[model samples]
Target chain A: MLALHAPASGGARLTAVNVAAEAVGLVIGDRLADARARESELQCHPADLAADRAALRKLALWATRYTPTTALWADGEAPDGFFLEVEGSAHLFGGEDALARDLGERLRGFGLDPKVAIADTVGAAYAVSRYSLQRLVIVPPKGMRDAISPLPLAALRLPADDCATLFRLGFKRIADLIGKPRAPLTARFGALLPLRLDQALGHAGEAIRPQLPPPAYQARLRFAEPILLQEHLIVATTALLEKLAPELERDGVALRKIGLRFFRVDGGVQSLTLGLASASRDARHITALVRLRLERLAEGLDAGFGFDTAVLDGLAVESVKTAQPGLAVQARALTEAEHRARLVDVLSQRLGAASVRHLSPRASHLPEEAATPLPALHGAPPAWLPPPRRGPRPPFLLPRAEPAEVMAGVPDHPPAQFRWRGVVHRVAAAEGPERIAAEWWKRPETPSTRDYYVVEDDAGRRFWLYRDGLYREAHPPKWFVHGLLP
Target chain B: MAPSLRPAAPPPLPLARTPTEALVNLRQTIARLEGRPVAEAAVPVLRFGCPEIDDHLPGGGIAPGSVNDIVPVGYDATPAALGFALALLAASQGPAALVQSRRLEAELGQPYGPGLQDAGIDPARLLVVSADSEADAQWAVEECLTAAALSFVVGLLGAPLSPTVGRRFSLAAQNAGHPLVLLHPHDTAGSNTADTRWLVATAPAARDRFGALGDPRWTVTLQRNRNGRTGQWILESGHGPHRFRVVETLADRPLPAPATIRRRR
Candidate 1:
C-alpha cells in the first residue's frame, strides 16, 4: 500500500539534489502555465500510485519469510514505504540492526531504493526516514527521542501547512514542543499534529491495519473500476494470479487447488475453484486452466452492481520446487489408467489431496495377509514403486460381511459345502491347505495358523475362504469368506 | 440404501514368495471375469494380512481389487470408537474419510484431527466429514463405495442399521473393492454391518505394574464374525503398550446364529 515518489527528477537526481520542490513548483498541477513560466528547469510527471503500491505489496509478501504479519501503509504524498513494527519480534532475524539490514537488502533486491528504521513508534521511524541522522535507523528505546529531535516538524506527520505555521511560531525542533500544552495546539490546528507527536514519542498507539488477518495466508488483488462485465473480472483475476504466482513460488509452494472469491460491492460473495493435476505456480497456465472452468460459471455469477474486490486463494498448499514448468503435456496420451488418475486428481481438489488414496500390500502368506492403506498425497505414483502387476485376483472379495456355516473335515480341510451370502454353494472343486502363520513378533500370545483354500462352487463361482486356528484344537475351525472369485 | 464401491490405490507392500506361488493354484478358481477362461484371466490373488485373521476369512485375504467391510463389535460401547476407525484408516491407500454424526465430536473431542494423528493416521489426509443422520452416512458411504478405485467405504451409523443398508454397502464394497468400517455406540445392540465385530477397548499396552514404558493394549471381544465363530481377545493398541489382550474368552463359547445361512459361495 506504500507509494514511493521521486524527487523532482527520478533516481539519478535523488542523490545529486534534494530537489523535491522545484519540480512540484513546475507545470504538473493546476498552475501548469504559471509553474512552467516560473521554473524552466522543471521535469514533471503525474504520480503512479498503481505501480508504487504494487511494488510495496511485493515487498510485504517477501517480508512474510520474516513474519506472517506484514502490512503496507501508503495513502499520502510521501514516497512509498512499509509500516512494519518488528519491535519485540525484531530479534528473530538477529536483533534490530540485522533485521533492518535484511529488510533494506531485500527491498533493494526487488529494485526499490529502500531505507528502513526500527523505532519505538512508526511515526518516529517515518520521521527518521524523512529527515534522519542515519539511514536504516534503529532507535533503541532509551534514546528514541534523540533520534527525531533534529528532524523537521513535518516529520512529526503533521499537515504541510500546519507544520509551516508551527515553524513560524518558533518551534524549530521537536524539543521546542515537548512541554507545550496540547489544548491550545488542538484548538488552533487539527488534533493530528499532537496525535502524531504522541505516536512518534511512543505514548499513543499507532496500529497498521494489515491487508489480512492473523495467519490468513490468502492474498487478494482489487480492480479500479466497479467491474460488472465478466471479461473485466477475467482481466482482474489474471492480474491477481500474476501477483500471487510469485509469492507462492518464493514459499516453495504449489497449488493443489485454488479458489477465487469475488466480493461484490453489493456485499455478495461468489467463488470459483480450480483443482490442479499437480500443484503449480505459473500464472498464465493456471489462469488458462481456471478460466475454462470459470467460463462455465458465467451463468452462476450474480453481479449486483459489480464486484470491487477479487481474492485468489491457495487452500491446498504443498511445498514443492517453485520453478516447475507446466505439465499439461504430462497429463496427455489419454490412456485408460491416466483417465482414472484424472478422476482421483479431481477428487483431491474438492476433498483435499489426502482424501484420495490407494493401498499398499503387506507381505504375508495368510489368506487374509494382504494390504494396508496410506494417503496418496502425490498424484502420480513414482516409477520407483511400480504398481503390482495384474495377477491372479478374485472377482469379488467376500463381504468380510458375515462368517459362513460349513460342514467340513479337519481343521485345515477345504469345505465340502459352505453357506455364504445367505445361500448354499456346494464345493465342486477345491485346492489345498495353504497354511498362513501369525506374526509372532507383533502378536505374542494370540493363537495362530490360517488354513486357506481356493475352492470352486458347483455353479463355477470361485470362493476365497479360511478356517481360523488349527484342526487339532478342540474348537472347530471357523468358516469365513475372505475374498471373491471372478 | 447401499453404497457403491470405488477402487482406490493403496500401499503396495512387496508380496512374499509363498502367497505369490499359492496364487497359481487359486488363479483358475477366481479369474477377473467368468466370461473369459482362467488361462486368459489374471490369477485371482487374495492376500489375507496376518495369517491368523485370514485363517477364518474366505479366500484367505481380500482379492487385490476387491473390497471388504469390517464392523467392530462393542463399537456402540467402546469409548475408543475411533480406535477401530484409525486402525482401518491407517491401513488405507488414498484417505480414510469418516462421515460421522455430530455426536462423535463430543466424545472423541471437539476436533477429531488430533486424535486421528495420535492414532497414527495423518489427520490432514483424514476427511472427518459430517452428515445429518444415518441416511446421510449411507449416502456418503454409497458415494465413496461406488468408485472403482476405492479401497474401502465405512458408514458409522448413529442408529441401528437395517439389513438392507448392510446389503447395499456390501454390494458397493464389491463393486469398488473398497472396504467399509462402521462404528456404532453401545446402543447398537442388534444391528450388524460388517464381516466381523470385536468388542474393543484401548487399555494399557501391558501392566504398567511392570513399568512398561510403551502404549496401552486393546481388549477386544469378538461379538460376531460372518464366518460363524465368536471369541474375545485382547490386543495392545499403541506401538509401546498396545498389545491386544483377551481378558475373557467368549472365544470357545459357541452361540447359534439367529437363522440358518445360505451362502452364495
Candidate 2:
C-alpha cells in the first residue's frame, strides 16, 4: 500500500492513496499514524504540489493533439483533470466514443488511469465523470439531465459544507431538485442550488479557456509506424503543407506565422515556429524556410524513440489578393523586391530575425543615435538623407567610448597627445572642437556638452576623440576615444 | 626531310572564324578538362578608375564573380583594409551585405552608419548580419552570394577559414555572379583560394590648400594575383563615389613626417 502525506494543523495526514491502500480501507484525510497502524506494510511519501502541477500542465499541452482547445480542471489546489472540447473534432477520430477510448488507451500506455467523460454541457460532464460508476461516460445531447440526475449533490461542484446542509434537508440526489420550485431553493440555499441545477440541465452556458489559442488553420497527420529520421519529418511536413495549401488558396489567405509540432511516442512534444518576411501561401517557399530552420537547430531534434503524430498550424494568417497572369508568351518571374524578401526570410530562419538587420537614419546629432538597426524581415528601409558635410565620421564606431589620458597645449585647444588602449600616441595633426551641445529640452537634467575632434596619430591611424565638458567645470574636462577612422 | 612537310598547317584551323573566337573555344575546352564551369566572356568587371592600378589587373579590372582577400598589414591597419573593401563594394553599384561574427564585432567595433555614408556607400543599400560564430559568418556570406539583387558580399572574420570552405565560397560566387571580399587580421596564417590578395596599410593624408586634412590615403600592395602581375601603389580617396587616385610609388617619395612630432605648448 502506498500513500502521499501532507502536513496538517493537527499532524501529518494522508492526501492521496493508491488502489492497494484504498482496498485496505485507508481513506484520505486519515492521520498517518492511524493509517500506519491499520496497515503495517503501508508506505508513505511527502507530497510535492508544485511539481505535480507542472507535470499536469505539460500533460495538458500534450493533449492538444486531439483538439486545439484543451483546458485544465482543478478541484482544490492543483489541477487533477483535463477538459478537451472535441465537439467538432470528434469525427476525425471516427466518433466521440472512439476518441474517448483512444484517449484512455494512450493515457494507460503512459502509466496513467484516466476517467473521461463526453457530454453536451460542462456541468453534466464534470458530474458524471467524477461520480458515475463507469470509468468512461458519454452523456448524449439533451440526455444531460437524465444522465446526472442520480448522482449526489457534491457532484454539482458545490462547497462541502453546502452539500452537508442540503443532505441534512433531505435533498440527497440531483433528481430530488429537478422539478422543484426555485423560490424556496433560492431562499433556503441562496441561489447556489438553482444555478448549478440550471447549468447541469444545459440551460446556462459555460466556457472553457483552452491551454493554447486555437490556430486559424491547422492540419494533422498520424503515422502507423513511428519515424525518427529528419528526412522523414521533412517529407511529412511537405505533405502536411500540401494539404493546407489548397485550403489557403481557396480562402485567398497567406500565413505570416507557422508552427510545426512533433508529438513523440514517449509523451514529449517539440515545436518550431517560423516567421515569414512577407505573407506567403507557396508551399515550396515555406518548406524551404522550414528546412533551413531544421538544419540550424544546435542540438537537433530529439525524437526520443520516435514521433507518431505531426501537426502544422497557421498561427497568424492574412488575406492576400491573387494576381491574375497576363496573356503573355512567358510567365513573369519574381521581381527584385520579392527575391530580396525570400532571401531575408531564409536568412532570418537560419540565423534568427534579430541577427539580420538593416540601418535606418534617425534625426539625431549624437553619432550612436544617428542610425538604428531594424530587422530585415520588417521590410525595406526608407531612403536615407545625405550625411551633412561637417566633418568625416569614422567608419567603425565603438559600442561605447573609452576614457583617454590627454596632454593639451592650451585650455581649449585640441589634444597634442593622448594615451589610449595602453599606447601613447603623438598627434601629428588635429582637426576639431566641433562643439555639440546636449538636448536639454528632451531631458530633465542637462548633460555635459561635447567638444569633438578628429585627430591623426603618428602612425597615420585616425581617432575620433571628444572632451566631456568645458575646461572651467569643477573637474577638468576628460577625454574619450569614441571611434576609429579609416 | 619529308620535303619540309608540316601537315599543311593543320588544315588552316577549320573551327576558328576569328582569333578571339578561337581563343574562347580553347578556354572553354580547358575549363571542361579542369571540371570547372566555363568562364563567360561578358562577366562584368569593376574598374578602380585609376590607370596606374587598373593597368596591373587582368581585364583592366577585377571580375565581379571572383573571391578576393584583404589582409591588414598591422593591428592598426585594419581600418585601412576595411576602407579598401568598402571602396570595392561601392564601385559595384547595387545592394551589399556585411557579415561578421559577434567575437569580431567585440574585438573591432560595430560598423557605424554615418561613417559608411561618409565612405560613399549608402547605408540603406547595405544589410548587416551578426553571426554567432566564425562558421556561421562564413555560411551567411555564402547565402548572401546566392541573392541576385546583391552586388557584393563582405565577411570579416577573426579566425582563418579552412580551404574547403573557401573553395565552396568561390564556387558559389562564381555561380551567382556576385563579388565576395573577405577581410582577415594580420595574424591569420591559413591559406585561401582567392583570385587576388591585397595587403593594405595606412598612409599619411595630404592637406588641402588651406592646410586642412584632405582625403584619406592607403598604401595597397597586390601581394598575389592568379592571372595578372603583382605590384604596390599609394592610393587616396577621390572627389566622388567609388573613385581613387594613385599618389606615387614607394620609391618615388620619402616618409612625410617623423614617428613622433611633439610641438611645444
Candidate 3:
C-alpha cells in the first residue's frame, strides 16, 4: 500500500492513496500519524505536484496523434487529467469507441490505469471520466445531460465549500438542479451551479486551450511498419514534403517555418524545426535544407524502437506569386540574387541563422554604434552613405576600447607614443583631436567627451586612439586604443 | 642518326618553343594532376595594375579561381595582412564572404562596417560569418566558395589548417570558380596547396607634399608562386588606379634610431 503526503496547516496529510491503502481505511486528508496507525504496512512518500503536472503535459502532447487539440484540465490545484477534442479525428481511428480503447490501451502500456470518457462537451467528459463507474464511457451526441444527471453535484467542479453547502441544501445529484429556476440557484450558489450545468449540457460554449496551436497546413503519413534508420527518416521526410508542397502550391502560398514531428512507437516524440530565409514551396530545395540539418544531427537523432508516424506542419506561411514559365525552350539558371538567398539558407541551416550576418552602417558617431551586424536572413542590407571626409576608419574594431599608456608632448596634443597589449610603440606621425561629444539625449548620464586621433606607429601600422575627457580634469585624461587600421 | 637507331629521337618530340612556354606547360600538367582546371586563359586574373608587381605574376596577375595564403610577418603586422586581403576582395568586383572564428575575433577584433566602406568595399556586398571554432570557420569558407554569386571568400583563422583541409579548400575553390584567401597568424607553419602565398609587413608610410601621414603602405613579399617568379616590393594604397601601387624605393634614406634609444628619448 502506497500513499503520497503533502504539508497542510495541521500537519502532513495524505494527498493520494492507492487501492490497497484505501481498502485499509486510510483516506485522503488523513494525517500521516493516524494513517500509520490505521495501516502499519503503508508506505508513504512526499507528493511532487510539479513533476506530476509535467508528465501529464507530456501525455497531453503525445495524445496529439489522435487529435490536434488537447488541453489539460486547469480547474484543479494540480492537473492530473487532460482532455482530447477528438470529434473530427475519431473517424481516422475507426470510431469513437475504438479511439477510446486505443487511448486506454496505450496509457495502460505505460503503467497508467486510465478511465477514458468521450462526450460532446469538455465539462461533461471531465465529469463523467472521473465519476462514472465503468472504465470507459462513450456518451453519444445529445446524450450528455442524461449521462451526467445522476452524478453528484460536486462533479460540476464547484468549490468544496459550495458542494458542502449544496449538500446541506439537500441537492445530492445533478438532477436535483436540472428543473430549478435560475433566480434561486444564482441567489444561493452565486451563479456557478447554473453556469457549470449549462456548460456541461452544451447550452454554453467553453473554449479548450490546446497545448499546441494547429498548423496552418499539415501533412501526415502512417507507416505500415515502424522504421528507425536515418536513411528511412530522410525518405519519409521527403515524402511528407512532397505531400505538403502541392497543398501549399494550390493556395499560392509558401512556408517560412516547417516543423517535422516523428511519433515513435514507444510514445516518444522527436521534433525538428527548420526556418527559411525566404518563403518557398520548392520541395527539393527545402528537402536539401532538411537534409543538411539531419546530417548534422545524424548521431544525435535517437530513434527509440522506431517511429510509426511522421507529420510535417507548416508553422508559418506567407502568400507568394507563382512564377509563370518563360516561353524559352530550356529553363534559365538561378539568378545572382537567387544564388545568394540559397546560400544564406543553406549556411543558416547548418551553422544557425545568428552566425551568418551582414554589416550595415548606422548613422552614429560613436565608433561601435556606427555599424551593426544583422542576420543575413533579413534580406539585402540597406545602402550605405558615402564615407565622410574624415580620418580613415580602421578595418578592425575591438569589441571595447582598451586603456593605453601614453607619453604626450603637449597637454591636448596627440600622444607621442603609446603602449598597447604590453607592446610599446613610438609614434611616427599623428593626425588630430577630432572632438566628439557624447550624445546627452541618448544617455542621461553622459560620458566624457573624446578627443580622437589617427596615429601611426613607426612600423606603419595605424591605430585609432582617443583621449577621454580634458587634461585639466582632476583625473588626468586616459588614453584608449579603439581600432586597428591597415 | 635514325640509321644509328631510335628513329632520330622522334624529331625531338616537338620541344617547347620557349622557356616560358615550357614553364606554362609544366604548370598546366601539375594543375591537371592536382584535379584543377588546366585551361590557363579561362581563369580570370586580378592585376595589381602596377607593372612592377604585375610583371612578376604569371598571366600578369593572380588567378581569381585559386587558393591564396596571406601571413603576417609578426603578430603586430596582422592588420597589414588583413588590409591586403580586403583590398584583393574589393578589387574582385563582386560580393564576398568573410569567415572568422570566435577566438580570432577575440584576439584581433571583428571587421568594422564603416571601415570597410572607407577602404572601398561596400558594406552591403560583404557577408560575415562568425563561427564558434576554427573547424566551423573552415567549413563556412568552403561553403561560401560554392556560391557562384560571391566573387571571393576570405577566412581569418586563428590556427593552422591541416594540409588535407587546405587541399580540399583549394579543390573546392577551383571547382566553384571562385577565389579564396586565408589569413594566418605569424606562427602558422606547414605547407599548403595554395597557388600563391604572400608574407606581408607594414612599411613606413611616405608623407604627402604637406608632410602629413600618407596612404597605408605594406612591404609585400610573394613568398611562394606556383606559376611565376617570387619577389618582394613595397606597395602603397590610395595612389594609382589599382588597389595598390609600387612605392619608389629610396636608395639613400638614413635608418631611424633604434627602439631602445627612441624610448630613452
Candidate 4:
C-alpha cells in the first residue's frame, strides 16, 4: 500500500516501491494506475530526488571498506548503483566470491536488496548484475565476450534510440554485433557503436576516478596487539615520524602541518592535527608538538578497546633548500631562528593556531589598515616603515570607533572637549588635524574623510579622536573616539 | 710579624652586654627562626634610570624574576597598566611574550606594534599570542613563563584569578628565573601570590614644546608589597634612560563628583 509515484510521460509511474507495495505485485517504474487496478487500495507518497541522491552518495563512501576507489554508476540520468574497483583488494577478504558475498550480506543486513557481480570490466559487471537471472557472477579474464553475448543490445550501454534501430535491423542480441565486421557497423551506427563494444570487451581502457586519493606523504604502523597505554602510543608515533621524516628530507620538503590518526580496535578513528610556524624536518620537534596536543586532547581520545594502527600524514608541506653552513655569526642567527620557530610551533599547538598571530604590514594609509594579524605559521616576517613623526599614535586602537560628542570653535579645528562612554573629558592640549581620506575604490557607497587629532584630557589621558566626515560636507560631521595614546 | 706565633691574651670581658648588642642578638635570632637571610644582597633588580623612581622601590627597583600584579583602577586605566608593563619588559634582557584572551583583546583592542616600539619595547623582541578563552590565556602564560628563552611573560586577564592558579604561575616564574606580569583589565578583586600588587590609574600626559600631549603618564599606587611599603607616584613612560621616570610635580587630583541624593516624593 506504500509507494512513491512520479508523473511520467504516460501516467503516474512508481518511482520507489516499499516492501509492502512490492509484495502486492508493485514495482518501480510501473504505471501506478495499473498497479492500483491490481490492488483495490494502495498508499502513495512523493519521491524526493535530492534526498535520494544524497543517500546514494553516503552509501558509496561506506563502500570504501571494500575498496578505496568507489564511484557512483548512473542508469540513464540517475545514480542507481556504485562501482568499486576491488582489483587487488578482494584477496584481503579471502577471494572475489567471498568479498562479493560479504558485501551483499552486509548490505542486506542494513535492509538493502543487493545484486552483486564481479567482472573484469565495468560494462560486463553492470550488464550481468542488472539483467542476468543469476544473483552473482564472476567473469575471469577475456570472459566478458561469452558473458555478455546472449544479453540484449541495451547491455552494450547504447542509447534507447540506437537499440530500437538495432532491433529493426535484426540485431537484437550482443552476439549479433560481436560477429559483424567493424567497418560496416561503424558506417551505419557511427564511431560510438564500436567504441562501446570495444570498451565492454576490454579492448579500450576505462578509468574510475576515485572520490578521494590517499595521502602522498604518510607512514602507517600496524600492531599485532592493540596498545592502550599513552606512553606506548607516543613510542609508536615517534617511530612513524622517524620513518616519514627521511622521505620528506629526500624530497627537499618540510612539513608545516601534520596529522596523527589512531585506528582503534573497535573500528573508530581519532585524529589530531598540528600546525607549525615554519617548515621543519626534525622528528624530535614534531614529537614534542604532538605530545603537547595529546595532553590537551586526552579526554576525547578514548582507546575504547585499544588502538591497533597509527598513521602519520604530512597534510601540508613546503619546499626548502637544504641548509649549508655559513659564517659563524650567521650560523648562530640561524640557530636562534630555528629555536624561535620550534617554540612557536609548540605554542601554536598548545593554544589554537588562530591564537598565535604575527603582524604583517598592509599598504594603506589608514591607521587600521597599517597592519593585520595572520596565523603565526602562515605569515612571513613583516617589513614596516618608521612611524610618522608628526604626531604620536595610540598604544591601542578601538576595534570599532565609538561615537562621541565633540565641541569645538572651528569646523576643521580639533575639539575642545568630548564626551565618551558617558564621561566628559576637557582637552588640556590639542594637536593638528591629520586628514585621512577613505578608500573610495573599495567602499564607494559611503565615502568618508576623517580629521584626526591627538587630544589629552584634563587627567592626562590622551585620546585619538576623529571627525568621521568633513565639515565641508552638507551634513554636520560625526565624531568618534578612535584610539588611546598610552 | 713572624715572632707573633703565640695566641694573644683575651681582653677582660664586660660583666654584661650593652643594650645595642642585646638588640642585635635578638634580630639575628628572629631572622634565623623566619628562615630568611638577615641581610641578603638586595634581590637583583632592573633599575629605572630616574633615581627618584628607583629609590621608591625596595632593593632600588623592580625584581625582574618575581610576579608583579597590575590592577586597572578605572576603564581608562588599561593603557596605563600596559604602558607600565611594557616599560618593565623593555628593561629586561631576553625576548618577551604577551598572552592575551580574545575577550581582553576585543575590549581593549590588540597591542599595536608601532605603538609598542614607540613605548620602547622593540617590536621584534615581542611575541603576541591571543588565546580563545581566559583559561587558555592563563595556560599559555604559565607555559611561556617556564620557557628559558623568554625574558618575561605578560598575561592579560578579564577577571582575577584564584589563589591556587596564581601560586602556580608564581612558582613557574621562579623556576624559569623570568619576570612575570599579570594585568587585570577590569577592577576585579581576589588574593594573588604576587610579590607586589599595583593599582595604576591614568595621570596627566606630559607637555611638549608646543604644549600638546607628549607622552603617557600613570599614577601608580603600591596597593600591596611584601617589602612593607605603600606609596603612590606619578610616572611617565618612554622617558629617561630607563624608559620611565617619576614626575616631581604631582598633578592635582579632581575631587570625585558629589553623589546625588533624591528627596522622598
- Return the TM-scores of chain A for each candidate in numbered order: 0.44, 0.91, 0.93, 0.79
lDDT of 4 at A348: 85
Instruction: Go through the candidates in order and give the C-alpha RMSD of each one to the true structure.
Output: 22.0, 5.1, 5.2, 8.8
True contacts kept of 4: 0.45
Give the candidates in order of TM-score, highest first.
3, 2, 4, 1
- Candidate 1, residue B108: lDDT: 35
Over the stretch B96-187, how does candidate 2's per-residue lDDT look in tens digits?
A: 89998887676567877888888888888888898997888888998889887688898888788899998898888888887789998777
Q: For candidate 2, give the lDDT of residue A332.
A: 68
Quality of model 4 by C-alpha lDDT: 0.76
Q: Give each model a TM-score.
A: 0.35, 0.89, 0.90, 0.79
Q: What is the lDDT of candidate 2?
A: 0.84
Candidate 2, which segments miss by more than 4 Å at Cα? A6-13, A31-46, A74-78, A183-193, A325-332, A409-411, A439-446, A470-478, B1-44, B189-191, B251-265
- Which of the two, 1 or 3, has more lDDT? 3
What is the DockQ for all candidates, taken in turn?
A: 0.02, 0.58, 0.62, 0.35
Rank candidates by lDDT, best first.
3, 2, 4, 1
Q: Please write out the lDDT profile of model 2 over residues A132-245, one tens digit for every residue.
A: 999899998899988998999988877778889989999999998799889988997787778878888888977888888999899999999999988899999999999899
lDDT values, one for every candidate: 0.56, 0.84, 0.84, 0.76
Instruction: Write the residue-wise lDDT of candidate 3 on A158-186 in tens digits.
Output: 88888898899899999888988899889
Q: Model 1 misses residue B148 by how many Å?
A: 8.8
lDDT per residue for candidate 1 within B26-135, as digits (tens), equals 54444433332333224333332444444444444433323233333443223344454455556555544556554553333222222233444544444334454456
Question: Comparing candidate 1 with candidate 3, which one achieves the higher TM-score?
Answer: 3
| Order of models, best DockQ first | 3, 2, 4, 1
List candidate 3 segments past 4 Å from native. A8-12, A31-33, A76-78, A295-299, A325-332, B1-44, B189-191, B239-241, B249-265
Q: What is candidate 2's CAPRI-style docking category based on DockQ? A: medium
